[model samples]
Every structure is written in structure tokens, then in C-alpha cells.
Target chain A: MRIFEYMGKELFSRFGLRVPKGRVVTTAYEAAWVATEIGSVAIKAQVLSGKRGKGGGIKFADTSAEAKKAARELLGMKIEGHTVEKLLIEEKLHIDREFYLSVTIDGGAKKPVIIASSQGGMDIEEVPENKIVKVHLDVELGIHPFIARNIVRRLGLDVGSRQGKELLNIILAAYKIFQEKDAILVEINPLVFCGEKIIAADAKVIIDSEALFRQKDIPYIEEQTEAEKLAQDLGISYVELEGDIAVMANGAGITMSTLDIIQRYGGAPADFMDVGGGTDMEATAKALEILLAKDPKVIFINIFGGITRCDDVAGAFAKVKKEHGIPVPVVIRLVGTNQEEGRRILREQGIEAYTNMDEAAAKAVELAALVPAGSL
Target chain B: MAIIVDQNTRVMVQGITGKQGSFHTRQMLAYGTKVVAGVAPGKGGSKFEDIPVYDTVRAVLQEHQVDASVIFIPAAFAKDAVLEALEAGIGTVVVITEHIPVQDEMEFIAYAQRKKAVLIGPNTFGIVSSGKCKIGIPPNQFFMPGPVGMVSRSGTLTYEIAGNLIAAGFGQSTAVGMGGDRIVGLTFIDVLKLFEADPETKAVVLIGEIGGNAEEEASVYIKEMTKPVVAYIAGKSAPPEKRMGHAGAIIRRGKGTYEGKVKALAEAGALVAEMPSEVPEMIRKLLA
Candidate 1:
């Protein structure tokens, strides 16, 4: 889950790392009041996307009036498709220099990697390899003080200097957050040197979703759509798309392959829904109900059941058609365990099911094209 | 002959009394798997379908000479269960549990490597050596002993392609699901190496999706194999930054794109199928 900048700063402060005092506000009046108290604040929009500075999501305000004006413009503004809902009003610091530091999992290496650079406040991908120092850390032996000090030294900072020691402390704190919080990524961009103190000017942290059960104390903001939230509650996976044909399958790969075949046959998918393994008739009905809410011209149900029985999926289609009355055409391809019973159940409802995925996908595309665009 | 498990391979079940564990144990036994012992912590001194249940892997080790361990423990206590098996000197461990914390997986997977053991998956459907042994949860009806070898990252897709292959008069020698997590214990290359050295396997089918560079890295090894490899990659129309059910099946930072994986596999001289249905025909022409 992606943590908001304000929450990440809160975590940073909790880990004994220095951060500019900030207050998160949702209204212009609150922003102005915070600016009056903090004096000369930087108004940063709270969104999940990066490059916020280039997108005009970050602005400076010297007075209360300027703070209100900036907050008014930033609120409800769209940056990379995320509407700014809250503003972080923080005390502005006079920075001498900026540096980049982060710790993330290297999937190929199967280990956590630490990346540090002298250049900051920009896309780390755009930075040249010569300017960045990357190190892989062993999970067995965590980041030691000497390991962090060496990373600081490689960035051309004096280990004996006060700023260097502060930078080392920040790096150690970032690693601590990465391990202690079950975080997948913990980044501090532009670790600014303000006179005598080094502080994390910006923070980004992404915690492991599977570890959320144990890390319950960390605050998380929901960034899912209503349909997505419904699917999550139902224990299914759903991704909304802009197309006329709705797709549902038993697993991720087969669902994606179903979408791929639909596009191959000249049809666009309205959404991606996976009922998952060992799904029962009730969960399948709930998944179909969520898909029908999109109002696609055609719905494609593909099942290559291993543990999931075909009869359960077909039973869902039958139950939904009988109760809610499906207005759109549904093309289903049922195979694997109990396929005969599944086909018999659908046939009793006056619906014919295909046995081949290609034929079923082509039929769905053909049916979708018969409907006029935007008619649904 | 199969690469991993066969009729003679002795297997042990962890969390054997749980719902999923007990259920698949019956299936594996019906398929003629030599399931010797089971570990269920407190349910010890009992028998799950006549297979002796012990308190721990160490207790089971004192009785039976087990070769591989299949785990169905929940994600919270999965780390301890796997460590117990590894500490008991089990060579092959297949973890079928899903939603394990990635940190826990990293620790156990690294330890498995240091012990020189083959860790199959932390979130997989397991492996089947067609008609001889069944480890995880793939339906046994679709498998038959033949010359083709299969490996996939997804479970149902493996069954989908396996059914198609059987329809086309081909059966698998072994099919391995490497799991759907971002960090898995085994990779495409590791299994491909085994199939390459196996004498009974004539051809291989590699099933991949939009994820890390596992497929792209496997392509380099495919170029050196003397046997033919037919590949199919799913999620061609998937949107970027969206986790499509699997934790690992997203395109992040402009990496692990469908086009890149397809290009690498094609360049390595493997016949890449555009759809799952096309795989059988490609294998027919190659093997014929």
C-alpha cells in the first residue's frame, strides 16, 4: 500500500529521523492557519503519483494569504490522474545541497538493495549510473553503521563532518523503516542540508500488502474505486477498463489471456475479473454482479477449472440470470472438472456454452460489435 | 522418467490436518504418491488416512526416510514450518500457501540456497510428474505420462495448456508451477536445466506472463538447449502498474513488458504462440 507523504513523514519522525514540522489540512482556511503558525510554508499536494513538483502540485507561500491562495489552487486539482485531496503545509528550509537515498527489494537478486546518489530532487531513473551508488544488503546482516558510512563516503561527503554524520543517520533510519515497517520501499529524496541539520525534505514509503495484517498500526489511505472495493470485499480481483466486453475467468493468467484473445478478435474489454481458485457459486455470483454493473455489451466467462469446478461458475451465471435478469449477452467457455454438469446447468437456462476459448471469444466479439457504440 | 517426483519418491505433509492439507493429501495418495508421514503440531499420535501424523518434521524424520515435504500451513506460521523441514535435512520443499510475507520468503529462500536444497514455491500449485506423483493441487485427470515437459508461473493456465496438449495427442512427463509471487524459490532456467538433462523429455513448453525478467533471463538458457522449447506469454493487453491478481504480474518502471519478453523468447529461437490454443499445433510440428 502507498503511504501518503504526511504519513511517511510521521513515520520518519517516529524513527528518530529529522523532518520539517508539518500539518496536513484539507481546507484553505486550515492551510492559512497552519502557515500563520509555522511561517513561510511549502504547500505540497498529497497524491500517490511522483513528479509532483513538475506537475505544479508543490508551491511555496510566504504569508497566510499566499498559503490560502496556493491551497485553493492545489485542492481538487488533478495531477497524473490523482485529485489532490489534502495539502501538507510544512516549514520551508534553506537548503545548502540535496541528496537521494532509498532502500527497496531487488527482485532478481532476492535481496534488499540500497541506492544513494549525490543528485536529488529529480527522477532517479534519469540520473546517470556514474552519479548513483547501488549496494545490495544481506537480510541476515542488516545495514551496519560502517556500511552506511561507506555509502555516505562514496557520495563524496566527509565522514568526520557534521553534515556527513547527519546523512549517515538518515540512511540508517531509512533502512530501519524499511525493515521494521515491512515496507517494500522507503525513499527520502532531497535529504537537504539546512545550515547545521540534515532533514528529509520529501518521503515516499510503500509497505508490503501481504504484511498489512501484522503492520496494522501504520495508517493507510484507500485508493481503490468503488467496484474495486466491492471486489476486494468479495474476495475477488477486478480491474476496470474502458471497453464494451466484460471478461471473467478462474485465474490471473487465464483471465489475462481471455482479455488478450478478446483484443485479438477486435474487441475491447470493459474490465478484468478473476474469481480465483476454489471459488463457490456464491462468490462467482458476486463477481458476475460486479461485472454486470459496468453494463458491457457482451460478457465473456472463461473457465479452465483445476480446483475450481465448472459447475460452480455455470451455477453463478444461472443464478444471476434468474434473479437480476442479465440484459447483456454472455458467452461462456467451460472446461476441466465437472464440465458436463456445468454445461447442463447453463443449457437448462437456455444459454449455450462453448468448449473452445477461441470460439467463445470470437462469438463474444461478434455479439459486442452488433450493439451500437455507447448504446448500453 | 520425471525430473522431480515419481512413484518411488517418499513425501511428507506439513499442516496435514488442515482443510487444504488434508484435502490434497487424499488426492496425492489416490494418484499413487508414496506419502509416508505427516506433521500437524498438536494433532500428533494420530493418523490422517493411515499416514502417521507427528508433532514436527523432526519427529517424522525419526520414523520415515522422507525425501520431499509439501507445506499447507497458513502464511503467518509458514516460515517456521519451512525452517523445520529444512533443518530436518529435507532436500526438496514445495510451499503451496499464498500471501506469505515477502520478507519471510526471502529469509527461507536464501537459507534453502545455502543448504543447497531446491525450494519450489511459497505460493504455487505444486508439481506433478504425470501418473507417477502429485505434490500440489493441480487436477490429476489432465496429466498423463509422455515425452513433453511443462513449466508455468500460473496454476490454471498450466492446466489450460496441459488439457490442450493432451487433446493434441501429447502428454507431459512433468509439469511444474514456479508460483505466482514476485520472488519465487525457483526460476524458469532452473527447471529448464533439469528438463534438458532428462533423457525421457523430448520437448518443453514454457508458460510466462507480464512480470519480472524471469522469461527474458530464461531465453538465454533456451538458446543453449538441444531440445525444442515452445513458449507462450499472457497479459499482452494488460495495463501497466495494475496488479492483475498475481502480486508479480505488473509492469513496473517500464520493465517486464509483454513485448520485451516475447521478443527475447522469439530471438532465442523458441516458437512463441500468440494464444494458448496455438501451443499444441506448434509442439506437434516440432515433435513430429
Candidate 2:
């Protein structure tokens, strides 16, 4: 969940980070008004992915007329699959110097790494390798004040200037904001300097998805439909497809392979629902219910246990059968630790478990063909 | 010495009251897995499949000497649940929750290593052995306790391959889904080592897909293994950008590309199959 510059600034401002005073507007008139107030402005389009400039999503405007024109052109433009419906008319700043500062997750390291550079404003990827500075920190160590000061010093910010401490303080504050928000990435691409004061000319923040439950205060995107929301609420993630078989399973890899197997077996998965690891009977039952709700032609529960037990899933099937009728035919293929016990439980409960995924999948397709098509 | 779990395993479920947890918990109990207890915070003192439900893993361990735990806690609390399970002296913790924050995973994985408790997955299907108790979610319909040992990065891929094995008249000894998350407790090589040593496991099935260097890394282990190993790698037709599949299966940064993994595995002297449908036949041919 990436936040645009307008939202990023709100967080940056709280940390005493400096930025060129500006306003965001959706209309041409408002854009012209901001242009008049700020004198000259940078007419930037708001889109999700990076490299907005290379995508021709950004333009500079000198006069109010030029700003309005640029904003109008950008407001309806599409950049990298995202529509630039909004424009950020920022006041043009007098940048004496610019530097980079960022906090991002290093995927391989599984930890947050703070990335900084003496060179900024231009593409960070193109920046000279020697100019960048990086620091990897443990989640427990956190971003302390000393670390911020050290980062500034390494960037040679002390160049005998009073702005050094101010820059350090702003960057430090931003780091705090980053941690508080559970941000996956908080970056100030160009921390601008004008005379003795430094300001955040640009800020980018990406919220970690798993932290969404904890981030009650942050606004969330409401793009998903009601059914999608319900599926997410159930803890298992699902994506609807055009296939006839509804696939439900335990892991991302499992979910994907379910879809692929369905395709290879001459069937398509109507949807993908991953109950995730360590699911219980109720969750598994609900996952099955959710698949049923999708009104799939056939339900295929493909599970390959590594830590999760098959007997537990069998119990979920029995429970679901007891609680609610399985509206559609189900083909369950589960194998992993405690598999025999899981099979016995399923057998005792009168729910059949398919030892072979291919056999079960074929059964699902055969069963799906038995049912007539109905709109969901 | 089947990988991950065998008959001696004492299993416990952490969110047993929930639909998914309860269902899988019963499966573990039914599989003769020595399931001692279940844990669901507010549902303490209750029972799931005749197993006592405790508030915490400590209580479960105190009541019954359990060594391994299977977690079905919600994504938000998955990391904490796994940590507590490890702290409770559960040597092996299976986390079946997905979408756990990367930060939570790093801390838990690092700590689990220090605590000497193996955490299988934040997103995994679970582990299983034929005729023994099972944990997590794996289909038991196809398994008949044969000589094949299986490990996979993708759950369905494992299922498809294992199905081929079953169809080919070979049953699985123990099948482990090593998880699809970027960081997991165990690796393909780790499970391969167990399979190589297991007397019952005459041949091994390794299911991999495009994404991550796991397959390439496991190739080295395949070379050292004494038994014949059959391999299958997917993602040959996956789009360059995330293939909209497994969270970790989406190849990026050119680290675990499909071509790279398949090439590496084939080079390491393991018999590699082309597709899921081709797996069982390839294994049978190699064994013969």
C-alpha cells in the first residue's frame, strides 16, 4: 500500500521535516489557484508505480496558466497502467543541495535497511554508486537518533553548516514515523537544502500489508467489492477467476499450483482461496463455505501438508458437513504429516479424502461437468 | 528417518477452535499423530477431538509432553504464536498462516534458530507420513505409506507429483511442503537429507517452481544423495512480472528464475521432469 506524495507529506510534516509549501488539487482551477499562491510550481501527476517522469507523468509549470494546462493534461493521463487523475502542485524550491534518505525492507535479509546518498533528485538507480550510503539494522535496534546523526555525517552533511543538525533531526523524525506506521518503505528521494534549512522535497511511504490490522488510523483502499471484502475478512485470501472449479488450499504455493493443476487437467479454477498455514477446522470449514459461496462448478481442496496435518483438515470437512450442507461436490486431496489420522477422521466422518491430487482434480472436473452452469 | 515428522511426533494445534484449526487438528489426531492438546486462547479448558484445549502452548506442554506444534492462529498473531510455541520447548513449530509481515517473519525465524526450534512455515500446508500421524493440511487419500519421500515449494505441485507417484504404484513415506514464503524454517536440502537417510524412502520427489534459489540450492544436496531423486520445476511459461501466483513463486530480481532452477537441478545429476503430468513416469523410469 503505497502512499502518494500528498499523504506522505502529512506524515513528514509531523516529524518537523521541511518541504516546499504546496497544495494538492483535483481540478484545473484549484491547480491555477495553488500556482498563483506558490508563484512557480511543479505540476506532478499522482500515480502508484515509480518512474513517473520517465512515464511522462510529470511536468514543470512556471506561470499559473502553464500550471493549469499541465495539471489538466496530467489529470486525465494514464501513466504505467494507473490514471493520473490527481495532481500535486508544489511550490518550486530553491535547492542549494539535495540528498537521499530512505527506510526499506531488504527482502533477502528480512530486515529493514536505511538507504541514503549524497546525490539526490535524479533517479536513485542512476546515481553514482559511490555517492550512496546504506545501513542495515535489526528490528530490535530500531532507528535511533545516533544512527540518524551518523547517516548525516556519512553523507558529509556537516560541511560546516547549521543545517546539518536540522537535516539529521528531520531524517530521524521520519524514521520514527516509518516505524510507527509499520512502513515497508519510507523514502525521501531528495531531501532538499535551501540556505541553512533542509526540507523533504519528496517522500514515499509503503505500508506493509500484514500490518493493516494494526494500522487502524490509516485510510485503506476500498477498491475491492463486497464479496472480496468478505473473503479477506475470513482470513483466507481469494481471487476470482473465470474457471469452473473453485480451488481452496493452505499456502500461496499450494493455491497457485491448484490453479495450474486445474488448467493442466482441462479445468479452470473459478477462484483461488488460500486458508494459509495452521488453519483449524472452523477456518477450513469457512474456507470451504467461501468456495461454495463462489458457486463453483466443483470444489477442489488441494492440500500438501508440511506442518499442517491432513486429519485436521478432514475434521474441518466433517464439521462443515455438520454445520452446513456442502452445496457443491468436493474433491479433497490432502497429504502430509499425520496424514493417516487425518484420512481416518475423514473416513470416520464419511468424508472421502483423495490421496492423489490428479485423481481428485479429475474427479472435480468430472463432477463440475455434472452440474449445469449457473450465474454467481 | 522421514523428513520433518514421523510416528513418534506429538502434535498440538494452536487455534483449534477456529474452523481451519479444528478441522486440521482432528486430522492430526486421526492420523495417529499423538496429538496431546490444542490451544485457543479464549476457548481454554474446552476440548477439540478429545484433546484438551489450553490457553497457551506452555499449558499444553505442561499437561502433555508434546515436542512439536502446528499453528493455525490468525495472520496478525501468527508470529507471536510461533514464538511462544518455540519458547515452550516445542522443538518443531509448523506455522500455517500466510501473509505474515516480513518483519515478523525475520525476527521469528532468527529467534527460532537461536531457540533451536525448527519453524516450518508462515505459509505452509504441513508435513505428513503414511500410516503415521500428520500435522497441518495434506490430502491423505493418495498416500499409502510407500517408498517415495516428497518435498515441495508449491503445495499443489507436491500434490500433483505425489499423485503421479501414487498412480505409478509408489506411495509416499513422508511429504513436506517447505513453504512458499521467502523465508521459511526448513529448506529443500534439509528435508532431502532426511529422505536420503530414511530406509523406507527408496526414491524422492522434489517439486519446485520458478522463483527463489531454493531449487538451485537443493540441487547440491541432490548430488550427494545416494538414492535416485525425481524433480519437477514449474514456471516455464510464467510472465516476467509476478505471475499472480504464490507470493514467493513470482520471480523477480532474476534470483530464482524458472530456467535457472531447472538448469541447475538437471546439471546436478537429478532426473528432472518437464511437467506435473510427467513426474510419476519419470520417477518410475529412473528407479527401474
Candidate 3:
């Protein structure tokens, strides 16, 4: 998960990388107080999305009153759809030179890659490819001392020089943090050399969500839409999207295929929900309830039942209709293990489940088109 | 012969006494797979479903000379279980446990490489060679031995496409789930290479989604292969940077997009199907 800059910097400090002293404040008054103590601070809005500087979510404050004004402008403002709920006030740095360094998994290579460049401040993509030196770390042996020195030397810094030593330390620390935190990425956009020292001007750390179970100390921030949160509470995977048709399936592959088929037939899917394998009747009912909250014009349920029982899905459909009453048109396609029993259950409930996926997808799209836009 | 396994392949089940282990073990046995033995750390000297249970993989290896091992241990102890199987000289290890720590996977994958062993997955559904043998949890009815070679990242999606192929009068030579994780051991290229060399396999079906460079990398290799290939990529409508059920399914930094994968595969001469149901028709046309 992507963390706030303050959290990333906090992690950097713990890993022995130098970061400018920073304080997190929630209100404009507190931002002013922290800025006064820091003396010429950078006021950064603590939102998850990047490009905050270009989006005007970041500001420079020379004095306490200026900091207050900047904070006021940043607070309660939405930058890239995320509101600035908190501000990170950090001591401004005087840099002799700026460089970039990051350690991230190269998905194609299936190895950890270190990307270092002499250019900084601008987007890494904007930097010319020739100026950047990329190195892939061995997954088994990890980062050798020579590999670290190679990156720093290529950046044109002397190994014995203060900035060079500091750069090496920062690179090592970043790799350590990336490894220890089970992080997918750990990046310092501008590792600035200030006279005799180097400090991380900006930091970004993204922890692997699947590895969160082992890293118990790191706090997980649940950033989700209201509909997403509702699905989470029901123990189902849900992703909110634009459009009027609600899409539900028993597996991730079928769910995505269902989504694709709907769009192929000129229908827009409002959400993506997967009930997962071996789901029972109650869980299916809960999944239905969560999707119902999205209030789509059509609800399309597709189950390619393997270990997942179709009878359970049919039972849930019957239960949900008998209790909550579905307001929209429901289209379902059930196949595979226990499919006959599932179809029988749905048929008894006066709801027909299609055996062909193509037929079901077309029908759902046709029904969705029949409803006027914004009618739901 | 199939790429990974056939009727003659000897198999062993690790964590055989556990709930999922016993359940899928029975399923595998019922499908005519040569499940010779089982291994549960403390369940040695016991028998599960008429199969001898050993405490360690070494002991199981002593009696059966197993060709592959399908692991069904809990996520917490999966790394050690796989390591044990690798250490016991099992050339092929299929890890069926999901949610294994990435660190653990990294270590085990490196170790497996050192031992010259093939690690299928840390979160896979294993491999099935149609009517010959089945080593995974895919429903038996969805498969029938024939000429199509299939490789997929997701388990259910593989089954979905396989069922569609069967309904359309096509059958699979070998279907492999390469695991739906970021750091899977067996990749699309790895399985594709095997399928390319297998005589029974006539064409290839690559099942991928909107994450990782597996599909992109596979396209590079497919550009040279002579066998016809058809692909179905999921998550075409998925949002960027959101985990869509599968942990590996995400679009980050403008990479791993559905359109990009489809374009690459199409450029490599592989027919790209818009939906799972469409894959069979594409394969039929390619062979025709």
C-alpha cells in the first residue's frame, strides 16, 4: 500500500537514512506552529496520490503566517480526488546537488532493480534514459558492496567523498528498508547533498499487501471507497467502477471475463465483485447485499463453479430476494460442479440461470440498455 | 507425451493429513493420477486414503521414487515444506498454498534453482494432463486429453477456458496454472517452452490478466515458435493500481495493461480473444 510521505520518511529514519526533521499536523493552526519551530519549512499535503507538487498540493512557507496561509489553501482541498486531511511540515534543505535513487522489483526480470540517476526533482520518466544507471540485484545473493559502489560511482561521485559515502549509505539503507518491510518499492526522488551531508528530500515506500501478515508492526491504512469498505466488511473482494451494471462472479478470472464481455456488448460495469471459492449461502447473500448498495441498473452474477457450489449461490439469491427484494434485473450464468443442483434451486425460486456465458452477457447488456441512463 | 505430467508420473502429497491436503488428494486419486505416497511431518506410519504417509519427503522418496510433489501446507509453513521436498531430491515441486510471504518465496525459489528443481507455484492449482493425469484441483469433467496446450495464471480462469474448449469439441494436452502471484517460479515462457517441445501439444493457449510482464515476455518467445497460439487476457476493464481479487492483477505506472498485453500477443502472431468463451473459437480457426 502507498503511504503518506511522513510515514515513508519515518521508515527511512529507522533504517538509518537521514531525513529532514518533520512534523505531521492536522489543522492550519498546528501547521503554523510546526513551521515556526522548523524555520523555513516545506508544507506538503498528506495525500496518497503522487504529483502533489504539480497539483499544487505542496507549498513553501518562509514564516509562521505564510505557513498558516499555505496550510489553509492546502487543507480541505482535493488534489487528484484525495482530500488533504493532514500536512507534513519539514525543514527545508539547502542542496549543493540533487540525485535520484530507488529500489523496486523489476516485474519482468523477476528481480530487485536499483535505478539511480544524476537528475532529480522532475519526474524520473522525464529524465533521459542515458543519464540513468539501472542495476538488477540478485535475489539470492542480495546487494553486494561492489554493486552499491558501482551505482554511486556511475553518478560521478567519489567513493571517499562525503556525498559519495552518504549516497552509498542511503542506497544500502533503501535496499534494507525495501527488504525488511517487504516493500514493492522504496524511492528517494531527490537525495540532496547539503555541504558535508546527504538527506532524503522526498521518500516513497509501498509495502506489499500480501506480506502484511508477517510485518505485524507496520500499521495498514485502509483507504477505500464507501462501497469498497462495505464489501470488505462482508469478506468479499469488490472494486468500484463507473457504469450502470453490477458485475459479480465466483472467481477472479471469470469476473474479469464477465466485465470484458459486458463492455464488448456495449454495457458498462458499475463494480467488480468476486465471491471467491467455496463460498456458502450466507456469504453469497452478503455479497449480494454489498453489490446492491452500489445501486446499479442491472446485477449480473456469473459463477463458473469449481469448488464453489452453485447451490449455495442459488440459495443466497433466493434468500436475498425473499428478504431484501432485488430492485433491479438480475442475470446469472452458472456452470461446472454442482451446477445442476444450483440451476434446480434457482428454477424453483422462479429465476432462470443461463448455462451459456455468451447468452447471459448479451441478455444483461440488452436489459441494461433498456433502462434509461441515471434511472437507477 | 505431455509437457509436465502424464499417466506414468508418480506423485506425492505433502501435508496429506490436513483438510485441503486430504480433500484434493482424494480428488487427484479419483482422476487416475499416480498418487503413490503422502508426507505429513508427524503423520508418519499412518495411511490416508490407502496411501502411505511419511513424516518427511525423504522417507516418501525412499519408497515411491516420486516424480512430483504437490504441497498443501498452511501458508505459515509452506516455505519449509517446499524446501524439504526440494532437499529430498524431488525434481518437481508444486506449491498450492496461497498468501505465502514474498520473502519466503524468494528464498525457496532461489533454493529450488540451486537444486535444479522446478517450483511450479507458491499459490498455484497445479498441473493437469487432461485424461492422462491430473495433479491440481481443477474439476475433472472440464478436461479431456487431446491436442491443445494451455498455460494460465489463475486457476478458475483456466478451468473456465478449458470448459469452453471442451464444449466447442476441443480437448487439452496439458493445462498448467503458473500461480497467480507476482513472483511465481514457473512463468509463461517456461511453460510455453515445454509446450513447444511436446509432440502431443498441437497449439498453445496463454491465459493472462492485467499484471506482470509474463504475457509481454511470452510474446517475445512466441514470435519464433511454429505452433499456433491463441490467448485470452482478463481484467480489460479493471481500474489502475487496484488489486482485482488476484494479488498479481494490477495496473501500475502505466505498465501491465490489458491492451498492451493483447497488442504484444497479437503482434507476435497469437490470436487474442476478447472473452474466455471466445478462446476456443480462435483456436479452432487457427488449427483450421
Q: Which residue pairs overlap in candidate 1's backbone?
A: none
Q: B15-80 in candidate 1: lDDT tens per residue?
A: 999999999999999888999999999889999999999998999988899999999999999999
What ranking of all candidate models by DockQ puts the best one first? 1, 3, 2
Candidate 2 per-residue lDDT over residues A56-145, each given as its tens digit = 877788899998888888897888667787888898888888888888765445566788887988877778888888887776667777
Residue A315, candidate 2: how far off, in angstroms? Answer: 21
Residue A180 shift from truth in candidate 3, angstroms: 1.2
Instruction: Report the lDDT tens digits of candidate 2 across residue range B1-288.
Output: 566678888788888899878777766666677888889898889887677899988777777888788888888888889889888778989888877876688788878877888778768777888888678777556566888888887665676566667777988898887787766778787788888888888888888877767788888878888998888776554554343446566665356776788788888888877556677787778677
Cα RMSD over interface residues, candidate 1: 0.9
Best by lDDT: 1
Model 1 chain A: lowest-lDDT 10 consecutive positions: A216-225
The parts of candidate 1 lying over 4 Å away from their true place are none
lDDT of each: 0.92, 0.77, 0.87
lDDT of 3 by residue, A1-376 (tens): 7878889998998989989888999999998999889899999999988778889988999999999999999999998789889999999889888888899887667678999999987778889999999998777888767789989899898988877777888888899999989998898988887889888999888888778888887778777888787777676788988888898897777788888889989999988898878877887898898888878888999999888888889889999999999999999999877889999998987779998888999999999899987675
Q: In candidate 3 chain A, what residue range of length 10 has the lowest lDDT sum?
A: A227-236
- Candidate 1's DockQ: 0.82
TM-score for each of the candidates: 0.98, 0.76, 0.97
- By summed lDDT, the worst window of 10 consecutive residues in model 1 chain B runs over B246-255
Q: Of the pair 2 and 3, which is ahead by DockQ? A: 3
